[model samples]
Target: MPTVHLLDYVAGNIRSLVNAINQVGYDVEWVKTPEDVKNAGKLILPGVGHFGHCLSQLDKGGFLEPIRQHIEAGKPFMGICVGLQALFQGSEEDNNVPGLGVIPMRIQKFNDTSKSVPHIGWNSAINTGSDDTKNESFYGLRPTSKYYYVHSYAAPYNPGVLESDGWSVATATYGEEEFIGAISRGNIFGAQFHPEKSGVAGLRAIHAFLNGDQFQSLSQDLVTGKENGLTRRVIACLDVRTNDSGDLVVTKGDQYDVREKSGADAGGSVRNLGKPVDMAKKYYEQGADEVTFLNITSFRNCPIADTPMLEILRRTSETVFVPLTIGGGIKDTVDTDGTRVPALDVATMYFKSGADKVSVGSDSVFAAEDYYRAGEKLSGQTAIETISKAYGKQAVVVSVDPKRVYVDKPEDTPHHTIKTQFPNSNGQSFCWYQCTVKGGRETRDIDVRQLVQAVEAMGAGEILLNCIDKDGSNAGFDLELIRDVKASIKIPVIASSGAGVPAHFAEVFNKTTTDAALGAGMFHRGEYTVSQVKDHLQTEGFLVRQFET
Candidate 1:
């Protein structure tokens, strides 16, 4: 086995890539400087950031020429995400920044039009070439091989030209466009999707790339959406808070204020419905595609010191096979000992405790405000950048808890206002989604649209769209909020808050561009199970992950 040289650009998920490679019995050596690239064996360039930013870093570190030389020498080389985009001529993301020009094609943003842009989540990659020799990167993958994707820009697929240019393309249709998913050109290969984050199929893809002949064809029955032809996720969200008795319980809140805090519970003032771990396990048993635990009160305390929260994750992961997301207080904090801890370190603790993703709410807004003050600047030290660099952008989620601020006219303020589906009491028709911090206690200058774009550039994988006004109201999801946020950003969005019934879930799925619909109040009140929601989604002619359980 040769040493797999993994390139680090100070922006990519070096940690997750290393873990994936090591899982398949391959030893990885991190390549930082140009000298490391020159001395590389079996090089792999994995990165995710602004297209221009990645290229600038590579050039500044003197890695461009050395990496090109290594690949030109016929060494096995691979690129992932931004790395793959870097191989093309340039990108629409930043037109001035030039790529390595290894391929003549220019990377373009998904031409989704009015649909979802980023095209996140699992999707099948149908191989264009029948011969394995032509499609070596997708060596053992079947026609419907599902790989996890998280990218807004992709290489344009010209089946004729790609095949003639010594590249075999596997394409996926996102909205109105069919873009390249994976490309293999001899020893030079690239994957627009993150193979490491693609789960079992992903692991196999990495293994086959490193250790030849290790790839095993999976059964069709094991595929996520083999029957439906497309994959959509159903998420179960648990709003966690401490009751009056100091016991951590899953609670439901209305309009960003939980029942426990107001002592307006139907059963008790505390609103202690059940334990976190127990409820999580119950949801997992009910065939939930994913689970999210939002520690509503963690904003007031140090999340790292929240032992019960970490304990819930550890215990739940042992039983829950799906992904687990934790939100609230995922920012930098000072410990009781007066030691300041970086937000990255805080996210690391959550990941170590079995959290697949961490949602940054208040911290993200602060980071964006800092960027706004610093001339559209971005620091690598921020929680979003650091966490994404370590765990991949797919692991970092930005929870946007925004409220509708109705006004007389759209142009009254400099914010992007939407015509409200539900008008205000004064009959004000236009409104702007005001971004909030500290669980909606304080509103920020930036709106939801600006925050979404800023955080995406800062390396947030997905956005957990939370509507403060509609939260726990059981009126249904804030469809207006969902549409506005979903249309603004290209990343995957999980529509949250104000889910009342099974029809609400279906409505969001059918009407909005959200990749997933999350429910807390409905699930907590025993109104609908995870399986029940999935069943309803399936019955409505929507694609959802089917479970025998």
Candidate 2:
């Protein structure tokens, strides 16, 4: 019941801050003047747009002195995005303009060519100082829970700061420069990324901040116990595809042809298959939390079984401990007697083959009644229970790929028809896209919100939501889509598609209620390693899983 004051300057992402604060059960009061900061339980200063203009606005509103006073008084204060940069003495974005100088550092532009400007995508972080106890404050961050970042300049960690990344700073990079993503000074915490825009992980950070001592205890418990609030994972997916040899692959740019008998084959012989096991191994190593492997392909032909791929996966499972959720090309299985094959029996095969979770996609959407009939024939709950008994409930994950459809439109207008001339524009009249399955080959008339409710009702433990429009773009997560789905469902939501950098992960966690983030391209290409990503999240004060020292 704390009244949180969100400092409202002309240059802040007000909406994002408000939504993030509200998500964690805190009441927010938007304040533009200095007097509004008085006696507040907590304070959030969010900055966006131009740096000079933001400082001028804060000065005009007489907030600079009050904010400084609040921090000096040991009040819990969080600076977001530019707000973090503003704490430094100054930034290269506007060198002539001075910052608040709360922290002894200067913001500078990243000149690295390996990274892009505006530091738009998801990136990771690393800790530099020798103090593991201080560094472990950010330990609960899973590799997939990345924060969002959008900036041109950042404050590089100096002697006063404890850590920095290698490529960027403290194992985190923005624009390929080692920049400070987060700076903590006692009760004052600042993040270069928007925690409000980040999904559940961001919210958890906020919740931890609000809870104060309770969160500290939880952190201590996590490091000591190593397992609390650890529950069964449910994940959703998007943009799944196969390599030329019909092996699972996730990439951003070109399509590479798979050659038979190539060294890429796991069999090490003349086998016509790619190595999905190699891909899965990378995911497990990265701390997937869980994965929903959607086979993004035109399912006109019967799904081919990659026996060699499965064998590799089986062999890989002997080493990997994470759960694998497999979806795509599953319809109905029949025996010689014409009796339906049980879901449990089929799931058992996947389990025996090293898959901990079996996700039904096109089969669940296109043949709903038949799918349910099959489920009933196989005893739906019985199947789930059997799998739960066998591998534990945490291993059972159901993936629902639902798209948004406008509900306020006229009945006569075609659902897919574009009334406006520009088909790709983000217009107010065009409210949503209908959920499609069968590799986007079939469209479902149901609204995405409704579909989420339905999926949750179907006893699914999780939902992996993906935006077809945003898939494989390497831009950023579709935050609006994620926000909507997260608001509608109680089940955990794994935001997929459009994860280009570690900062994007931070944004996803800050912006929505998404429990996890799933990406294929950034990891596969060696742009970021799992530890690098996790370290970045930790520096930003996110709760992530950490290796016990």
Candidate 3:
């Protein structure tokens, strides 16, 4: 097998990149020091998180010059995500920090006025200079393919600006902003989106770059459309726990209950759906935009490094290219060996194990309550703060589990309440979403609005908003809750729970401003595949990412 040099810089989930490379028949060689770059024939820099941190780290580690020398020596080099951003001179994200100055361009944050700031999800990377007659896709890129992108800053696309400088560019539009998604020049390649997580389409790009095949012509049938915008993301969630037999299994809960409702073994055995790793791959193949495994079963008595969930993440990422989020047990805890582990360390374990993002559930509620108790002051020591600081905030996701608390009007109990469309048994016309913890086993004093706001201030990148009233109900998403939550936070909100059918997904997308929608039972029970929901969304005049062949 051929070998390509990869830089182990910063903290992120780079396992999938390695997996992608291996799948494409290339083995990865670590480019550890400045001296290592001179011997490399093909080098790839994979990065995530902040631009300043990426460039500053490389410079601090004495790698900046060697990388420059590698490119000047005309060796093949590729940059991904922040690795790509580091080629520019500087960015609006950090004016004090200087990039490699390779491109003489600046990256700017996307406008949040019309859409989400991070510009998360699948978007097209169309090569503007493609041959229309031959249907050439620059470096395995296609008009129809949508690559996974999650970033706040990007290089704004200006027609012929980089081309005049002998650089080829592919652009994707987010709202009204057109930005560079991928760019290439002699001996150099950069992708703002994550190719490793883009499924088969991304694997082809990696193969092309490694094989030095830039201008791969495509069949006209592959060019399905010129739609070049961020599409809606449909995520598949697996609630995983141990059954009565002590075997790890994927399980679903009804309003947070995971026991059998009826039978001789009623309420005796935990519901077993399937295996975590196998189910994850199945969803990926079914066109699920992302797969999440919430490790609901406790492993506190076991060592963090030896947890079974880590192994699950490791195995699942090898085959599932899309983003994988791990929730539950993300708080600080004492290991079985009497070693105290911080939440950041727990998150690092998961990230290194191949989780793209770490979702905080119960801990977030406690943190938010503490925040309000301290008069909205930051402690800078909480799980969210520490983790977000180490890895970019984009890597930290707050999983909110809230139950609807009914009231007659907005003034009831001094909580932020909305006029409810569905009245309670007592004829209450208003409701405030009260946050819950321990898988909705306990209710907190804080409201959902307060919890999300506090976490966002604490530097959480996204929210996994789950409604206790909706989970496993197969009724539909709590639209009123989703809308209120979306209205409160600037970061992305994933509407989870209560998705029964494909039409339910469409209803959430149409009725609410949620950035993404998640399905668990529907996908788990073979009731609906992710492709069906995406197809429904597409038919309803919405853009969605189709599974690449």
Candidate 4:
């Protein structure tokens, strides 16, 4: 049996890919050195990260030449996501850097201004050419097979590269342009979308790639394959922090402030309500479509050092089958012993600990600032871009904590300000949301709209729109804030904070185009269950998953 060698670089989704390949009964070996690449029977280069960084790492590790030689030898090889981009001569992501030139094309960032940049969701790939039944990638894939994609740049399909006798390609149209979704020239295969995360349709492609069979048969009943027809998701959030007793517990704070009064007790207010794993399992059992654990103090401490957070994830993942998102304190860290860790490495650890997506809060503010100052995303490596690349953008979410700054006139500030339905203390008529970092402790000059645009361009798969003013107030979601931010960006937006009742859940979904609604205190305190929220939405004529009794 031929073994599949997965190129384990700093920017690849090694764990997810390993799980996917292993599910198909293939033994995967990690390849780092050129010798490993040369000796491997079949090679797979998988990555999600910046164009220059990925290419630079490959060059520095001496795997570049071996990769080119492997493709030249006509042995079976596959390039996934960034790996597919690396096969091209260059990318617009970093114009100065060049790829391996295996495909003789230049990668271009999606340039259509009308559509969202990082096309982050389930989209379909269709056959672009004459019916070629022999194409390996599309062998068992049905027409218009929906696959999960998280990319800002892609290889522009050019017939010149299809000169090889067996060369064929499939296209996925995004915005106004059509780009190559899958490519195969002789024994080499590449896909811009992630098959590992695409469910059954994607796994079929992986199985076919391994067996060297052009066609794989599926049962007639299973023909209607797995599609990410994800409806509006209901997510349960647990704001976790260390209580006065130094125990990790879920706590809810009012307007981003969790304080215990001097009159309450010694030390501080005991906001410790419940344990993390316990709450997570409870929410999962209650039919939460997803669960999020925010290490409320993670910004002050290195996540790598937070063994408790990792344990929470490991324990919860075993019991919960739904998607899991983790946020708080996900920045680059330097240890006291002089050891430095990249932000992407931190994300890898989170994923390995069973986090399906890692959310960045303060780091996103900084990345947006740098990107705006440089006028291009090539300014510096950011956690959002790097992590999104390694895990695919869908696995990365940006949590924005924006406090509404009411202003009398929008023109007074350079940032985009919205007229308020409710007036401020001075009876101010207009307001602009100021993006904050450090758990909303420090405010920045950046506007929430500007930050959203910048992070989306930088490759954030989704936005966790949080309002510091409405947080834990239970008044309701800041509809103006959610609507304004949703109008500015095309990526899926999850309206966070200020959801008090079942009606509030329907209000956000009914009024705005938010892809999901998240609740914390309401669900955590037993006031309402995830099922209750879904029941209300369902009664309101909204599509919701009916929990199995």
Candidate closest to the true structure, highest TM-score: 3
Point out where model 3 deviates above 4 Å: 131-134
Kindly list the per-residue Cα lDDT of model 1 for residues 1-549, writing each as its tens digit.
457998877543355566667767888888878898888878888877578878888998899999889989988788888888888989998899899999987998776656565667666666665343332335445444566677778887776897887676777776657788777776777788777755555666677777644224455443324431346777888889888787889987677666555434554565667889999888867867678999988834543566578888777765554667898778888876678888888787777676878999899998998888888888787999988876667789999989989999988989999887678899999999999998889988889999998999898989999899888888989888888887777678889888888889899988887888888888888988888887887799876654432
Root mean square deviation (Cα) for candidate 2 = 19.6
Report lDDT (Cα) of residue 543, candidate 2: 61
Global lDDT of each candidate: 0.77, 0.55, 0.91, 0.78
Pairs that collide, model 1: 118-490
Worst 10 residues of 1 by lDDT: 220-229
Query: Ten-residue segment with the worst summed lDDT in candidate 3?
Result: 129-138
Lowest summed-lDDT stretch of 10 residues in model 4? 221-230
User: What's the number of clashes in each of the models?
Assistant: 1, 50, 0, 5
Q: Which ten residues in a row have the lowest lDDT in candidate 2?
A: 227-236
Instruction: Quote the lDDT for 134 in model 3.
Output: 60
> 434-492 in candidate 2: lDDT tens per residue?
66775555677655665555544454455566666666567887787777776665555
- lDDT, residue 345, candidate 3: 91
Candidate 4: tens digits of C-alpha lDDT, residues 390-463 = 66677889999999888779889998999988998799989999999988999999999999999888878889
Model 2 scores a C-alpha lDDT of 0.55
Report how far residue 363 has shifted in candidate 4, in Å: 5.4
lDDT of 3 by residue, 1-549 (tens): 999999998888889899999999999999888999888999999988888888889999999999999988899999999999989999998999998889998999888887776778899899877645667667888888899998999999999999999888888998899999999998889999999999998998999999999777788777656788889999999999888887889999999899988988687789889999999999999999999999887574577788889999999999999999999899998888888999999999999899999999999999999999999999999999999888888889999999998877787678999998899889998999999889888998889999999999999999999998999999999999999999998999999999999999999999999999999999899998999999999999999998877
TM-score per model over all chains: 0.73, 0.47, 0.98, 0.71
Highest lDDT against the true fold, candidate: 3
Q: Over 4 Å off in model 2, which ranges?
A: 1-274, 295-309, 334-340, 366-393, 404-426, 547-549
